[model samples]
Target: MDPLNNMLTILDAEMGAPSRIEKTGSWAVRFDEYQQFRIGAVLRGDIWLRVDGGAPRRLSEGDCYLLGDGKPHVIGSDLTAPASDGDAETAETGGLETARSAAADPAAISSVVLTGSLGLDQATEPLLRSRIPGYVEMKSSSYRSQVARPILELLSRENAWEIPDADLMRLHLSRILLIQLVRTALRTADGCAAAPPDRLLTRMDERIRCALDLIHRQPSKRWTVANLAAAAHMSRSVFAARFRTAVGMPPLEYLEMWRIRSAAAVLQSTDRTVSSVAAQFGYSADSTFSRAFKRVTGRAPKQYRQLAA
Candidate 1:
């Protein structure tokens, strides 16, 4: 098994998904619902992050911060500090005034803030949660430093106003930053693996990745234990056992999850009927699809589509 090829396949699938972006006053932020890994790039000014009981951490210009779990955290300017019950107007006015004044500063230039929540899906959540710290900061330098600078500029530019394709541009730039962040996070100081040592892949790990790719690339195809084992070049017993150990679930269970995820994409992005999506994913009947979808997502296809829409 080629370890490099397997790693590349995993990364390629992770990077192919779309990321989301929003503009709030002076801040332009991008995030994904997947929430496996969380990242935030601060382009201009400073952001004060208020975690439940911890003191606020200040994120300055050109800084990138990552939060491994999608832990509940609040980020804003200094005005985000603890306030009285009726100090809403005071905080709002203060934040707006500060952001406005900062934008007016010719020296302020432009800054970008990028944040992402990183996780390896539900299967790997426990491993990541136990291994990674609450947050890790990478001081951008050399090539990474150069690459991040422009992303910050773009974010700052978009936050100025509703420019043409501004949101689209921010989303694209955020995606690039995300890829770079993940790459950096995967390689260690000594060039060894940066992902948890215990989580590092073995020979069998490569095969599991291959099997996962097969499921992701063709979720609509009928997949059985025997067929998947053959695809991974392993015997049924060995493949099933090793796959569960490496990927944290039985092969068929992972396939069902991927199928629901695929159907979700269609339901959210396309006008296709639920029955059409059900058939697209090889379900014999819409009821089966709905039951499976509800099992995975906790909402029926129709309700999920409506809420997503």
Candidate 2:
């Protein structure tokens, strides 16, 4: 496969589908933690989105926002309104459930936000994940999201009904649109105009590419800095520095990060025991892996599992 395709494929694996996809009305999650990759499309009406204390920005119908790094953001009908939580209200356009504020004015919220949780938190594959972006907002009219707009429309239409086939179609189309959206967003990055964004995978420093591939393709392997350097055909010092410059982290650190991220996905999506999950990732003792996991993820394996659950 071509380099761009290869990178896209890797990113596809990293992000997967939008977990816990939902369409909500007048939404605002006050304590925003950008822990999960989020792709949101304004399926109906208009909403205001603000991130990291920035000014509120308007997202009209057909706009999509991607948060790969999970930068916290708030979206609602009115940004200044107090955070409200109530039973989900049925959407007029889509059969999706939307949260309605319990207030005297029933028509207070007119926006239906289709939110998809992109689980990048579960996959820290350094090569593609770190290189792209953590936060990006593109309008349907922008050069970046031209194709994304149509895909979003299809998703909006698919979500509008309760057909049995609509579920599968919505799931698959959401995944496709996400990959396409990420690709377009990366193209707007620096030096992207001169080269295909995926060239980062194919056109990387030869040695660094070798190391990155080794780590991502074999996260189960017990790898060391020495092994990665040898794979890159560089001296230890040169390899470490070059790897940092190219991939944004030391070789060994990347391995641990990838392992922990994999562990998170497994823990969140499965009923696997901590010991078994740790062992699967090459940790000899559950405690050793627990410390490593906690160091990287801020929660113990069991605790993280509970949170995921």
Candidate 3:
């Protein structure tokens, strides 16, 4: 599998069903900092989006954005407009919620935005945080528009009609949209970067990906920074520096995290004893394994298993 797909699988990311946000006249909504990844598309009219006190940018019809930084942001017809809490304007419509301007006039509705979140687990949050920018904008004029436009159109159509399995269809389409957006973002310049892209993981460096794939595919294997660098065809010092810059952590540290996290999953799901599970993931001693597990999970194997059971 590709690196992004592999990381998604490990993270157990779930793309939630989409919601429609309709607004009229001068309206702005503030979305507080959130933990789950967020995606939004302007399906009609134009809106302004600002993240974490950053300058607002205009998003025309068909434009979309993905949020990875978990920072507070605002979206509206006008950035200078008085804002309302996004949560307060939410109302259920046909099993899905719709957000509207504080003083909404249905007849004068000017903007329709499609938004959703991708739920992920703690184990792989760092992988996303380190690789993806806090915010990314995919413009309608960009090369990715060919893929994004049709998907957004379909989502808009699905939201409007009452069809068979409509909820399921929207859910699936939203997932595809998010996946495509991330895939494109990895290949293109990250919008959040101040200068021309100079980061390692933001642009999907193939060499770094190769080293990451090896560690992810075989976390149980004994790994060292030097070996990982060698696999990536770089000298030890260069590889270590690059790996840290790309992943926000050293190679061996990442391997340990993956190993402990994978072992935690096994401990929770299977009947295997602590030592066997530890050994399966390359832990040589029960005491050592227990210490590592505790450090990561705040609980030892037996305690964790019992709680899970």
Top-TM-score structure, candidate number: 3
Candidate 3, pairs of clashing residues: none
Ranking by TM-score: 3, 2, 1
Rank ordering of all candidates by lDDT, starting from the highest: 3, 2, 1
- Badly placed stretches (over 4 Å) of model 2 are 10-31, 85-95, 103-109, 120-125, 142-171, 189-195, 199-207, 213-233, 237-309
- lDDT values, one for every candidate: 0.56, 0.63, 0.73
Q: Which of the two, 1 or 2, has more lDDT?
A: 2
In model 2, the clashing pairs are 25-99, 34-70, 69-134, 89-98, 94-160
Query: 1 or 2: which has the higher TM-score?
Result: 2
Model 2, 233-272: lDDT tens per residue?
A: 9999999998887766777877787778767778877897
Instruction: Determine the C-alpha RMSD for candidate 3 after optimal superposition of all C-alphas.
Output: 7.4
Q: What are the models' TM-scores?
A: 0.50, 0.55, 0.61
Q: After superposition, how far is residue 21 of candidate 3 from its true place, in Å?
A: 1.7
| Runs off by more than 4 Å, candidate 3 | 1-5, 8-11, 91-95, 102-105, 142-175, 190-213, 220-309
Q: What are the per-residue Cα lDDT tens digits for candidate 1 across 193-309?
A: 465422334334677767876776676889999999999899999999988776667888877876776677678888988888898887989889989989987899999888665
* RMSD, every candidate, angstroms: 9.2, 9.0, 7.4
Worst 10 residues of 2 by lDDT: 85-94
